[model samples]
Target: MEEKLTDRMCPNCNDYLFYMEYNTEIPYEGNITIKTYLCKSCYYKDVSIKRHDMEKPKILKLKIRNKNDLKTIIYRSPDASIKIPEIDAEISPGIASRGYITTVEGLITGIKEKLSLMDSHDAIYIEERINNILKKNSEEITLIIDDSSGKSKINSGRAEVIEK
Candidate 1:
């Protein structure tokens, strides 16, 4: 692993901020670069990850039947589009989007957090429905990931992959 740190001017304030970059290799996976920015003056932070290897476009689908399914690991690339059709929720890659690996439950939680930020009536309703699903009180949900970079994957035998 290699790491670097530099000072940058904060966008909110003219104060100096810390910019960090790291390059690391994961076993069975390719090399990745992680970049982070932190501004102490404005308490702002941002993080993103990029894979070094090129990949083909692909789509992944997974069904969540029970609590055990929530523990399954999911790797999402920055260019991937995540969709939960049951709830009519979708997250597409954007300028501020970042790549990360997390469990199914964590993904739902992340979605809830984003919805909460919207402060809209529809967002709140969808968030509540997602929470019910997370609690296993609702019907099973399906997770679909369309990755143009093909770096995203669901680490489970139940996951279906289709090359685009």
Candidate 2:
């Protein structure tokens, strides 16, 4: 099921083309609500997911040791935090943070894309580390997803779940 909302204005374009979609049947997130936002005027988009069951919070960890591990899929809530200590990378939720589902490789690639937008020396160095991870050159990178709301998860048997 889905609900369409269109009574909002785009923050970027200040146009009345902002829309939201609420979905109830997202895979791997049983009894969860997924909110998606889009702005037709500015081409802005975002997604957030929350569990209706209100389960306990959890910290999920996955070790990426081979190419198959990079194919692991995960759903990240807007309030979740992602960390890869191997690359000294951490992504915490902010005002503009959004949620979505993607593979481990896709997540790392997304980080690389964001880092590429920066002009600082640190960003370039981090981008190179991210490249090594993406190229499967890094040895045993650990992917951590901490979600206080327990709305994020790794959809693989290899994932380690720590209830908090």
Question: What is every candidate's alpha-carbon RMSD to the true fold?
Answer: 4.9, 5.2
Per-candidate TM equals: 0.71, 0.70
Q: Report, for every candidate in turn, its global Cα lDDT versus the true structure.
A: 0.84, 0.80
Q: After superposition, how far is residue 137 of candidate 1 from its true place, in Å?
A: 3.9
Best-fitting candidate, measured by lDDT? Answer: 1
lDDT of 1 by residue, 125-157 (tens): 999998888886487889999998888989999
Per candidate, the number of residue pairs that clash is 0, 0
Runs of candidate 1 with Cα error greater than 4 angstroms are: 1-24, 27-29, 32-50
lDDT of prediction 2: 0.80
In terms of TM-score, how similar is model 2 to the real structure?
0.70
Winning model by TM-score: 1
- Candidate 2 C-alpha lDDT tens digits along 1-164: 44355777777887664445464665545676656677766787766665566557899999988888888988998779999998777899887676689999999998888889989899999898777767855777999999887889898898999999
